[model samples]
Target chain A: MSEKSPEELYAERVKRVLDVAALRVPDRVPVFGPYQLYPYTFAGVSFKDAMNDYALAREACHKFQDYFQPDLDFGPILAYPAPAMEMLDIKWFRWAGHGLGDHVMYQYIESENMTADEYDEFLYDPSHFMMSKWLPRSFPPLAGLAGWPAVRTFMWFGWTGGYVGLAAPEVQEALRNAAAAGEELGRWFDSIGQYADETKAKGNPQAYAGFDWPPFDIIGDTLRGTREILADMRRRPDKLHDALEIATKIFVEYGSGAAGAELPLCWIWMHKGTRNFMSDAQFGEFYWPYLRKGMLALIDQGIIPVVYCEADVESRLEHFADVPPGKVIYHVSTTDMVKAKSVLGGIATIAGNVPNVMLLSGTPDDVREYCKNLIDTVGKGGGFIMDAAVMLDEAKPENLKAMIDFTKEYGVYQ
Target chain B: MKEQLVSAIADMREEEALQLAQQMLDAGEDPQAVLDAGKEAMTVVGDRYEDGEYFLPELIIAGDMLKAIGDMVKPMLQAQASQTEPLGKIVLGTVAGDIHDLGKDVVGFMLDISNFEVHDLGVDVPPEKFIQAIQEVNPEVVGLSGFLTLAFDQMRVTIEAIKEAGLRDSVKIMIGGAIMDDSAAQYIGADAYGPDATAAVKLAKSWTGGK
Candidate 1:
């Protein structure tokens, strides 16, 4: 067995991915790379350092390829602009040395940034509400927004005292800083795009085209916060449903715009809709309908939606039956894979559930054993993409190496 | 009227609850009675949460309502009743590296309703702050909360800090949040693990012997 050329590797990888994606048994099961924050950790570069300097991040990516050489890589880590966040003095997220020590990772600060009584205002005009209300409250630097006139008044009438604030030195400084940060992030993303192209040229394929949010997560995570959103279900059910419907409509429109493109993949991050988060009835009423609608629309436009089911979704797998078979991929993180495969085997390609705790603390043998079982069971017929339960970060390199090695050998179809 | 107050709160009718509290106060009802009614309503809320009828939003709204009523009734109680004692004192935070706090807030609400003095250090609390809070609050128990995998290490360091400061023996240590199991609790040197907000209160009561 001589080394295959880059062209051969790329062809073989794409064919295998498309085969399992269609629930057809290809030559073997495809291995997925969940390398989220691990590349920086592996390169001995802190998350803050990498976020501040794209060169450090690019260096980590180079290190990532040298190690696992995974079949697919998620686009970029710390895509958020650290400099913009620093300039804005944003309190919603804390990076290294900002809240924790310099070596600690970044985290999002969850707060009831939007109050319960403000639902009507938000539902009426989301753009104006976000710019004037949510932005100022969530980002400290944008507190000047409260001084601006209603966005509707400005847009419709085109003359107001709001424009005066734009001339203030502090507001001007904030605007300048934000614009500079946007340019910085644009360059960063461009470099990452170039990196993706280079990796594709080297035979590793990119899996996702763009990212979107499930309607419930967009509401719960940013708009209402988790606790507030859940309470609205009982107290203000009508308002909550209205918000979900609007969110679904917006997502479908945005998602369809990217259809029939080169990537043709929509990554939907699923949160706050699983069994652990809601009751079966609550999930059915509040979550599934809106999300399914957006998914079906995306599918109608020739886009394959890959739903990343976070947390325990074992009991909620039945809700996915509405989508057409082989048009979706469900990447679940903490559910029973055996049960998931039993439920969703022919319906879609099932990925993930290798525990991150095992990857972080366990030995190479443990990693190999877990991958072996997943391949033998879920990889039996087809429609199984081997993945980690959580995004791989700070995992032992040897353990990750063992997982890839074991999957390549044991995942072969007889 | 008391039953109505409880029903209003348990049903999450905020305006109705406030009106009921005000009406009862004007009719010369004891402020302590009003406080008891609020606690009973929270008990119902907690029960609903465990039964899957309520979730974080319910808990948050209920907690907010209870605080509103408590603020109104507290001044009157402080002036009228001088001998009433709180159930217990506990210090809670979301640990050093993690900022997720939905579970922490729920646990704090449960403890607040149970008449415990809860000092929540908020999210992304460092180990030194835990040590500082333990020294200042002199709590009977300290809870380290986190939702990510890295929180395990933060929990361990916080517990170690308590031991180093000679406060480990004075306070019971517990850990809670997502991604936490018995093994994780044991690994972090916690005395016990609570899977939910209600269970956390139960564990705290057992440790304080219903003080």
Candidate 2:
């Protein structure tokens, strides 16, 4: 018999993932390897070099896939373009070779990019707010955009005067810097795109086609900052609701548009809305409605929404039952897998719960034992994916190998 | 009035809490009483937090209320010259190479409200800095905080440095973060691991024999 081609393998892996998403039993439970800088570490490549050199980053990612061979490939997506971010002077992230040591992973710096009183302005004209206010605050190189006239002003005779702002020397410089950054981003995307194609050709499917955040997180994480947004819930609940409403629509469009049929998954990193961050009532009121709406919208577009619950979301599992059966996957971090399976068992696909600390600090035997238990319980029938509780940055190499190899071996269906 | 103040703060009535605090000071109430009431309200907030009724937002706003009330009464309390001794001194920091500090800050705030003098060394604190702070402050308890996986080694290294400096036995060490647990605490050679700020306060209080 002729051996299966890479295309066939790719199709098989994709089907395995989608089968779990649709709550059907697959040939075996798929294992997802979600690591940010582990590949660089494993390949003996410095994060600084990878972020600066796209080719080296791609090599490191390919090397990692060649070794682990998990069903889904992460590619070099987390190896952010440090030079482009530097040129733009983006304040949201501090990457390697910039503010952090060359070996360190990038860390997000959160602050209130938008003040409390600006909700009205943001709600009224988000584009102007982003260009004139948010962008300038987030990226210092774009500070000149603050002086540019509102886009709405460019009507009939206003268009002639509106073009005047573009002629400003600082604004011109900002445009040049932005264009240069865009070109840098284009190069980075091209490299990542090539890596994805190569990995697909090698029989590995990429995890997510696009990424998104819940509207509440978009406000809490990027706009008002976590503390400020939470306070806003008490101080200005009405305005917060209005802002979330706007964000929901914007995110749905952004999420669906970015994802394609080639890989029909939109990854949403849920930062807040956990039990420690808010009450179940608060989550229901401020967080869940819009998130459910966004997920349903993405599903309407035939894209599966993969929500990575970052923190302990055990108490909030019941709320996820609202999603359409077999349409969404909850990649939980600190949630109890037993409870998750019972609650979301046939309702939605569940993945993860392996303690990252175990992978980092435990022995290979410990990792293997834990994986066996997870496979026995969470991976009982079907509709579950094996993964670390959180993205791995530092881990014991032997332990990671044990997790992947053990899960693949013992997670077979009868 | 004190019950009103407590309930106002505990219920997260930020504006009303501040107004009530200001009103009490204007009425010439003993500054210590207002401070005591703020502490009492914080305990209620902490209890709710432990019970999972209140979360980060409630804790933050409660801390803010206490700070405002402290500001209002500090000068007056100083003029009276009747400040009580703090329960204990605790050195705290988010360990080296990890800059995430939301959890650390919350722990610091809770410790401060719990009446421990917290010497927060801020984020990305190296082992040498921790040893230096340990020597300088001579704190009763040291809390190491980090939210990332890399922090495990850093925490172990920091504890080792503390031991090398001959200060390990002098202080009861505790580790706290989202990723921390008893096993990690054991691995890092800490006396205990607190999952949240409340747990940190409890550990500190137990170590110092404070009520």
Please, what are the lDDT tens digits per residue for candidate 1 over residues A1-414? Answer: 129987788778778877777788978777875465677778888877777777667777777775776677664544455776776777677787677555555776667766888888879888778877777787777776655456466564465555765576766655666677678767877878887787787777776776789998888887788877877887789999998988998788767755865557688888788655667788899999999999998988888888887676887889875678888888877778998888898899888967776777779998899998999888889989888776666678898888877888888898
Q: How accurate is candidate 2 locally (lDDT)?
A: 0.88
Local distance difference test, each candidate: 0.79, 0.88
Report how far residue A177 has shifted in candidate 1, in Å.
4.8
Give the range of the ten consecutive residues with the poorest summed lDDT in model 2 chain B. B75-84
Candidate 2 per-residue lDDT, tens place, A1-414, comes to: 029788888998899888888889998988985688899999999999999999999999999898888889989999998889889988988878788888888998889999998999999998899888888899999998888788798998998988997798988887888899999999999999999999998988998888899999988898899889987878899999999999999889879864566668888989887657788989999999999999898998889999988777888998988888999999878788999889998899898967888888899999999889988888988989999988888788888888888888899898
Best by DockQ: 2
Q: Residue by residue across B79-115, what tens digits does model 1's lDDT show?
A: 7654347778999999877878777887898888777
Q: Looking at model 2, how many pairs of residues clash?
A: 0
Q: Give TM-scores for every candidate, taking all chains together and pairing residue i with residue i.
A: 0.89, 0.97
Residue-level lDDT of model 2, residues B49-71, one tens digit each, is 87888888788788778888888
Q: Which stretches of candidate 2 lie over 4 Å from their true place?
A: A1-3, B74-81
Model 1 regions lying over 4 Å from their true place: A77-79, A87-91, A111-121, A131-178, A261-263, B78-89, B114-117, B132-141, B163-172, B205-211
Clashes of each: 3, 0
